[model samples]
Target: MRFSMHSTLFDPDALPFRRALIAGIACVAAVVAGAMLADQPYLIFAGLAGLVYVGTLTVNCRALAWLVIALQPAALIVPFFPGRPFWWELCALLAWPSLLAYGLVNRRKIEVVAFDRAERWALAALGGYVAVILGTMAYRGVGLRIFGGEQMGGRVYVQQLVLSILPVLMLLAGFSQKQLRMAMITGWLLSLTYIVSELTFARSQDMAPLLYFFELPVDGLNFSTGYDASGVRRFGSLAAVAGAGLSLLWVAAPLRELLGRWLLVTGPLMVALVGLGLGSGYRNVFASAICTLFFLAWVQRFWNPSRVISMVLVGAVMVGGLYFFAKELPLSVQRSVSFFPGIAISPIAKADAATTNSDRVEVLKLAIADSPKYWLFGRGFGMDRFDRLPVDDPNDSVSMLYSQGMFYNGFLGTLLKLGVFGLLCSLLFVWHVSKIALQLGLLVRRRTPSEWSFFDRVCLLLCAQWFAAVLLFYLTNGDVTWWMQSFGLLAGLLMACRRLKQDEGFVVDSDGVPKASVTA
Candidate 1:
């Protein structure tokens, strides 16, 4: 009763014509794509093309993989700015139509959209964070005057508007399995770009040796340096700096597989990483890098325990030998060419040498003392100044309280902002979503088939990035920029992942490409 003419439909020799078409498609797609997805029409077209592409997916993976990994950073990043001459952007804008068009050509069809626990948490968190931030603003008692109404009271309601709309746009993007793979590959490419630029700044080197694969002119970019002297690395998009480090940390690690052990030598990716570290000049980047590595190592370890133990043992032996030699060395020798200080026995200690831990801890304590207020609708959102007047506060606590506003606006506004119901839901959502991602990650390895796909891996990466960024942001800078952008990206990424997971009809090849490949 089967429709196939032969029993060996999956056999390599059976589908010669289909395979050839797929191969031909792969070779020509990139060369043909020379447009950008700019403006509202292009964005809509991009979404529709994604819809069509997902529908036509057939599963000849080799070529499919090529398309997913093909996008260059210049294609996406440049168009966001006002003026940039890039044919690639035009191609990206137009290529989407081809994906949809492929469905009509081949007639394979699928209907899919993704939704899951992470999306729910993102929704809850975005609401809660905004409410709390705005509530703090209102509690200062000039809430009405600042906005001229009961509106958000931040410095710029505009970025807040962007933060609000971004999630909706992502939801509209209509994620599919192919999209997720494409995104991860994109993430890897961009992360590599950022790291390379950072490293160039550090060593004062040419970007060609670092990012020559794409032939981008990487010279003279400010961040061409590493971690940054201020221990920060801000991105061009938004005033935020927290997530870029996490992104770099991640894209490099999973990317190591693509590079293999040869990354240690003169690999393009390796050069980019080195340039990022050197260019930033910030020690915090090093900390974030360590955290990223440790997380990756732990994840890999979770899958392969014996390999973990062996690596740990080897590392311990090397450290012990170094310590023993340092102890036996003369003071003059130690002073001149010592391998480490007593604390330098660990890499973390060595990196922490030029950092200011005690001062940050002190400043954080000062910031926290003015918190935990009780304002139902407390301070005005835009009222963080010293009451726009000179205050004579002798003590740190009093200074913080008065500087918060002329009068102390306690936690009442916090209640109105959170509204009691939101607070409870926020707590529950965090508990649930965190647990789910952790379970799914381990389950994808231990319980589910190894066929969990690229989108799954990318979602895992997004989670890892968020977690790492949260840790680093808390330690480095507690600015609103850190919180807002982290949550914003997290929200957008989650929604995109949701659409990918929920939609199942798109047939994907092993490397995360659709077979029919969008010809546009």
Candidate 2:
């Protein structure tokens, strides 16, 4: 009898067995490879993990999303290989292709929604931003090699630009509100792990392995060694952003309801997470957390008489505590509060804060002074030999000022790299997304507490608050790439929410609450 490939291998009845056999074979191959690379244990384990991850993705493509979100914080801190693409960077590099393949295979099942007016504007702005990047590269004669270069060129800039927007994959993945909420929570918890580990290791002056493996070099300081005069450690990571934003959810009744009796622990948990985040000694994180909480309260309408009075009492008590214990507190805490006028803090904290402020001002001045030359078209991304001059060199300041400006100031940096046009594009992208958020906030306000599900409300609140905080960060501290990622996530959340609301088959009960819907 002639062997039929479809009947013998690809038949639906034989599919499960085939998958099992393939998995077994893969496991055996991994074992053999592990033996061969026993001396390089890290490489062997990484290979084995990759095999398992691929297998899981094949079984359920949705797992890819969970992994992406859950590993997001770790990605910032860990590297797949030394001094190479960070974990998050590698995820971005791999995610799009995997998503595309999944989409192509499941094309018939996937709904292709037309771009709405807001989405169109957002895309236009993004397109303009990309155009500016390319235009600058062409104008400056920079080669587009993304990896393995002593100097950062157009390729590095392009790579960062792509990675920043990769969170948009959440939109294409057709994630439900529940899935998004879970992923956000998972990411938040993972971020807390980082925060706790940092706090635990800081006292001993030993770096956590998670933070030590990559050692993201900023200026001359690594994450673990950066410290203040009072011996308070000061390390920065995107994890601080993620942890603080989600921790603010402790005040939400919807979240409380979802957690049931577990709600009792949320308040203290939030305090711990936020406190540890602040302990990282990044005032930007503290500022972002406060802004997020303010926005959350505003959106959630927590201005009721009792709530307002409670908030006032809490604020007063915090002020009193700080006033009494200012000198006794950790230097990081003192530094964080030093941004507020008349907040009593140690002299060391005050001096540190002033020094930081002075540095930022100098960088801003340099950026503004040089803005005229690259006003229309940017100097382009990457450093030249002159830009990389040693810090000790007397002549390096003026020569490297442009690159320093790009690194330190967000708005001015955009202008230097992509020019005025690119900055406008960036602003436009922010404007459109803010508009969408405003619209969503209005819609949420109109709904009763019962009408909205716990997951949907929390997801919307988290995204909105995080987006607002990122905007604040961009304006003050700079980090265009982080801003881009926040925008992408907010846009994706909005897209998913709109789809859920517009789906024809979705049902609502007499109380206006969604019934048996993905959102519900």
Candidate 3:
């Protein structure tokens, strides 16, 4: 493989045939070498697939961003590696270096957005929180490990932190708003596969064979099915709420534009998505979806007479249908609606809610009592020892402490893990982000619908609603890993939207429908 002095294999402008041939040969060699080294012929296929992926990434750096986005939900369902440092974690770790390499190769000037007062405060608070994390880690003598540890160890904490900050890095690395939107849409679509699988194959027995093919001997893939007191199966997914929010946004305008007058087909599909999400039997997910829909309705100005009548009709039909089938419906579906007035809740649903609420109250009490001890400084990340007791054991204080630290009960978790100082930092972070999101919302509200692109408007609405949901969930059902990453991404999108409005001059005439514009 003789090459010209000016033509290196890694050159972006290298000949296509030469590059492909060299890459193919290298890939084959790697596969053969790996198979020989491992003494496993099956390793060849894995090596080949990995090499191909890497080759594609080298050719298109943006694919790395897409991979990170797609892996959000995938890391939850697919058993890539058993324990810590899952596929998403690995991708996130790679993202920073990949972004840096791309920047170096392209020699593009990195654009820095000026931070406003709120942004500065948010950044400062985030830095303070991180400093506290480090201080605690050092005081506790916890070593930083990037891979393979117990569930709530330092590695997991650091990985979550990395995932949380990834979107900002992507934005700094020059990812465009259109690219992010496409990535999100792709992720949501991919998550639907897992959702559909869960819904269709409710029984573990039926899904066991399929899941087995994806699992390794060391993989601790959880295939447990959740059921309500009435023995009705509940279908939950890692991305259920987020997916539902995105689906609702799509249906609001994007889907309508894509499938004009094809309501018969797309309408049912959207309904199915919303229904599947609500079927998760999680009140938090249901609440988040409702909040998102409400925000969408308000932002889109659905108060027009025609839209009002349509919504009323739809609501009436849905309510009437549910009323008739309430008893026959799955308990999970019934529980989802149990919050509304005039809906009859089954005894099972009521008992289940009561029991769960009681347990949560107990956890909250424990968290409150123990929070004072860690008021000045937190117990530190990865301090929770799951091996102290069985995870399911109610007496497991360590497990409860872990949950509290991860924001299982929202701010209480922050208080427990990061102490009062950390709590303040978190509050500041949320406050500033909320302030920015609100300002953006109000800014968009003042503009005529035609002045702003539909994409930008939708992005703002979605981001705002997502952040609002984070606030709400923080009060109770906080999953820091998922929620923090979502917060970072949405925060980045909010910034991107602001940039489009201010920098790109995105304005369309009344006669011209809004289209997506690429942002630098």
Candidate 4:
């Protein structure tokens, strides 16, 4: 039986609540006393408070969603220093308890689906990997020596367990379609915040102190104005820049009633998109965002043919503009814009854009070569780097000079840690997410005029962008386990929201509220 928060039996203010409150107080007292006796009561109260805060917030999924959205960027920056607990892991720990309590109170059951099964399978594979690591540590009887020791192994083991499993569980436990939109809107707001912060940092001399005062990462902040060795001024990390472009792309494609058709078709919206891409020096991110926009336009072609045509025309113009004005553009912009010169149908041409692709290919080859030796189960986590005998050859130069680690590649890293079986499980998880996203995308496409279509479309766009980011990161940034963990969380939440939408059998109205009747 579902119990509302207002019900006398469930409400904290009611008579029965006093007994429950007394028990809770006793438990808290017992915990505190035990901690004190153990001589480890430090920060216990603070930890308890944090738990209470998260528990309270998660009872409302909307609040939880917003919290998740806000935490995304913070998670990347806050945990920069070593020996610090990850913010998202803490979020997961607190969220699970509250999620369980809410589920018990409301008598909610987990709905089983194909994707959920895939998620479980993935979890099991990860569990097996952990088990192997632990078992090896035990069997070898390794000690606490830090370097290449069991202590380091244990830490790596624990870190992976928490990051890999907790986020997925937290999202799967609680999320709805409304919450999904809330996350997307929050993401957009964050993008705008990034833009504002970058502009401020560039324009103001004293902004560094202000940014530091707000606990933001000052050194890593990129305003897309500084040039690299190649004279390219990349906006930010691949994910950050791609995410910013995604925000602009979502709104750029459709301004339905807010602006005229011509504006949506050929004017300011398109200009903003190009500006965003040019500003972000990341070629992969720009291409990914543009591809996502094109995909969306293609999907909505039946509903909005003019938008599609406009996008095609925009691409042609972009190519031509790059060809004619290649050198006229800023050096940073020219570095990216010059890629179109070869196919621009003009005499003007420039060398193909510079890249680290060769370095990445070398790393991938190394990963491929090492995969077979550890084919069944991997050497264990945190042991991705190795020594190669032929390292002295000047012709065989690679980024990893002293000790070779997989550089700018994650698939190899995954294979190095979890082996072929684990790799399959991870791939299954991706397959499941892709399937659900496509289904949801098709649903939104068919239900043309539905009120929530815009939000759904954005979610679809985000999913595509996410997939692109994954590919980009795998190829160009090996230390993307952070990204993968977060992706797992996002995919789980998205799937959960899709499940809720399917079960509810209704459509959102113009006011952005779900209506009882389903849209045709």
Best by lDDT: 2
Estimate every model's Cα lDDT from 0 to 1: 0.42, 0.61, 0.57, 0.51
The residue-by-residue lDDT of candidate 3 on 331-391, one tens digit each, is 7676666656677768776565556566666666666777777778766556435432224
Model 1 — which ten-residue stretch has the worst lDDT?
405-414
Greater TM-score among 3 and 4 belongs to 3
Ranking by TM-score: 2, 3, 4, 1
Decoy 1 TM-score against native: 0.49
Q: Report clash pairs, candidate 3.
A: 410-474
Query: Candidate 4 residues 173-209, lDDT tens each?
Result: 4555565666656655554444444545555776654
Between candidates 2 and 3, name the one with more favorable lDDT. Answer: 2
lDDT comparing candidate 3 with the true structure: 0.57
Q: Where does candidate 2 stray beyond 4 Å?
A: 1-61, 75-84, 106-111, 141-150, 153-158, 164-167, 195-232, 235-248, 251-274, 304-310, 385-409, 504-520
Model 3 steric clash total? 1
Best by TM-score: 2
Q: Write the per-residue lDDT of candidate 2 for residues 1-520, one digit (tens) a residue.
A: 9978778776757976689788988889877886878578777777778767665552344555556666565425454454455555566666666676766776765456455677668778877877877777667756443455555555456565665445356556666766766776767665545444445455544554555544332331433554543455565543354454555464346542423444457645655556666655667666676677677767766557766686678668766876787778677767777887787788877887787677677667767777787879877665565553334453533434535443466687777667899889988977776766665555465566556666547645755575665567567856554545556555655655555554534453432233443453
Cα RMSD for candidates in order: 14.9, 6.4, 7.4, 8.7
Return the TM-score for candidate 3, rounded to 2 decimals. Answer: 0.72
Across residues 141-177, which tens digit of lDDT does each residue of candidate 1 receive?
4322344644323433323433443443445444456
